[model samples]
Target: MQVAVINRSHHPLPAYQTEHAAGLDVRANLDAAVTLAPLERALIPTGLYLEIPPGYEAQVRPRSGLAYKHGIGIVNSPGTIDADYRGEVKVLLVNLSNEPFVVQDGERIAQLVFARHETVQWQQVAELSETGRGAGGYGSTGTR
Candidate 1:
């Protein structure tokens, strides 16, 4: 599961904080601090270019600590980086709190999770089989 990457920022490459961590922390590659007013969003660059393998994708996600502490999150949660994409990784960050938040250079702003995906082929069919909970969706089951 090796990926080809080019890092132009002064920050080190993204890495998992824990041994069993699923995602690697990605940093912001800014020369100076950028302030985000409440309810504002910005496109922050990572200065990382990756070459993901076919059938795989890089998922950019928000950090739980930042979300809980500062109400900072990704505008498009789990933003997908397609395998064919070869551009610098950028994160769409949003401030959900009522106060401003500052993003510093080389700050851990997001996480990247590499996952394998499948391509689907549509099959024309007349009818489909029935199940116990047929077509149940969107809170069909109780939270409990």
Candidate 2:
């Protein structure tokens, strides 16, 4: 699947780190470092503009290493970039730890995963079909 993209950042285009990697690492495009205090969030730009296919979407997700090491994560996990969007790709980053997190220019902050999605049509049914565990949710099953 080929996607049309425009790169205006100093760093190279986002790419898969491994052969079997599902998401591509996206970098932060900034003139100077941006510090995020604990529990603070900021919208960091990537300087990337993409043209996704009609049946697909670009999912912006947090990097596991950053989350585990620095308590850095995306405010809106797995943010959806619609196919019709034609603006710069920005990430909503948040600091979950007590210390402030500094985001440097060209730093890998998020991962982009392109996924296929389906548009569903409402059937306007009278009732939904019954299941084995109907209406049972929120820890209905035991942890053990």
Clash count for each candidate, listed in order shown: 0, 0
* Candidate number with greatest TM-score: 2
- Candidate 2 vs. true structure, TM-score: 0.97
True-structure RMSD for candidate 2: 1.3
List residue ranges in candidate 1 displaced over 4 A.
Answer: none
Q: Against the true structure, candidate 2 has what lDDT?
A: 0.97
When summed lDDT is taken over every stretch of 10 residues in candidate 2, the lowest stretch is 135-144
lDDT of 1: 0.96
Per-candidate TM-scores read 0.95, 0.97
lDDT by residue (tens digit), candidate 1, 15-40: 99999999999999998899999999
The Cα local distance difference test for each model comes to: 0.96, 0.97
